[model samples]
Target: MVIPTTSISTDSLTSLASPSPTLDFYDSPEPAFSFLVQRIDSLLDCSSAQKTHHQRRLPSLTSFVRQVYVKCRLSPAILVIALIYIQRLQHELPIDSKGDYDTPHKVFLAAIILACKFNDDSKSRVQSIYQCVSVVYTNIDVNEMERSFLGVVNYDLYVDIKQLCQFIQEHPTLELNWED
Candidate 1:
């Protein structure tokens, strides 16, 4: 499938050049695009040779993320926000050392879902796409994951401009794009 060219329009809930006063998911020259993908893929920690038994059943993390990004037409800001959610959730949730729960994939999924819901204007369309994609997850499973994530994070979904700028500056690659 052809991925539409990304653009930026902060006039809505989103931007193309820099982090606006609020969060937005518009197409812009995403110099940070590849960096964002790499960052999320690294978080999965499941390379082809290192795939856990469960991971083997799913698409490569990079593949899964790209599919979601392209199909959903997600903006770079949404991508950044998803990473933030993942980081926050990692601290709030009690990850199971035994490897039963808190799988990176699940956390990634929930973060993306939350980000999409929070950032997208045509939420119903976005929601419909999520229900269909995201690999083997059913709608109910998606709902539970989202609910669990919100509970753990105390429903803190806000991504302000300063916070976004801070996160970008912290991630050198992203900062480069924002500065350019």
Candidate 2:
């Protein structure tokens, strides 16, 4: 059996080409972009009308995290270490106080040591960091702080630096690029 095939010429196809009505998607009666623009413009207009509106602004995630740490009576450095340690251990450490929580000298030391281990920097040494903490907290005894640091930290000195580096790499918002 023989099959017959029909093919249209390129010239004929070119001749049929004609400009049609150009309808922009954004020009629709209820365009999404237009709604967004209107909402933004409304917000801009209302922004100047009331001071309370500015106060209603949501706290940033970082600020919220810091607030959580503050509530736990943890210094910013300790909070940072806690976060890193938690990530490393894949578990939350008990916040039980063996003694008075008022002077968390041991916790401070532990945090500094943890940070140093994870960071692998000599700048955050236990003694120097403790000294800095002592200066900042004038009432606190440096010897006591050092003792508490040693006591709390004990043998758990090893920290996974690789994990910390990986976490930092993944979270660009952390801004961990510190220059010496």
Candidate 3:
């Protein structure tokens, strides 16, 4: 449950998190990754001060999630599951005339936390998972987010393996270049 001290440069972060723009999920990680990144980037106002804030600016959601995955030593399938959770949540709470209740970091972290619990053989403690996510979320925030996520998904944590396989088979690129 310890995070390594080695700092991952933002440049390296981009490479790690970069999914192909053409990525079709039928789709899985690609849609979720793009959705999260797009939501976050829209908030950054990156054009305001390009040079000064360039180095110290907060990392993109994609990069941060990549860091969490690496730091927590989570399997790639955790990400896939998290994305599925997100899709289900969207289905439950459609972003329409109703407000956007899903805060970017909280939702993303909660999805990953749930994914870990659902997919991992050795379950990760909430506190330990918080260690990797504390930069963007507090412990209480994580707790609330987990609750919110469970509510959104209707507490249905089970993933259908046949459906997942079919999805991968339908979208060969997701299976082939999942690392992207």
Name the candidate that leads on lDDT: 1
RMSD of each: 5.5, 25.8, 10.5
> How big is the positional error of residue 47 in model 3, measured in Å on the Cα after superposition?
16
Order the candidates by lDDT, highest first: 1, 3, 2
Q: For candidate 1, lDDT tens digit of each residue in 20-122?
A: 4433333332435555555544443332453454355666555566667766666666678787887676567554422322244566677887877776556
lDDT at position 19, candidate 2: 32
Clashes of each: 8, 0, 1
lDDT of 2 by residue, 119-168 (tens): 33444343445454442333255445544454544534343334434554
Clashing pairs in 1: 6-27, 7-27, 7-28, 8-27, 8-28, 10-14, 13-24, 14-24
Which residue ranges in model 2 land beyond 4 Å of their true spot? Answer: 1-83, 86-92, 95-109, 117-125, 135-154, 177-180
Give the alpha carbon lDDT tens digit for every residue of 1-180 in model 3.
Answer: 442322211111122233322212342344445654564434322233224332234465577766666667554455555666766776676444232323555567888788766654334544567887665556887888899779877997676554444444564444423222
Q: What TM-score does candidate 2 reach?
A: 0.31
For candidate 2, what's the RMSD?
Answer: 25.8
Full-model lDDT, candidate 3: 0.54
* Residue-pair clash count for candidate 2: 0
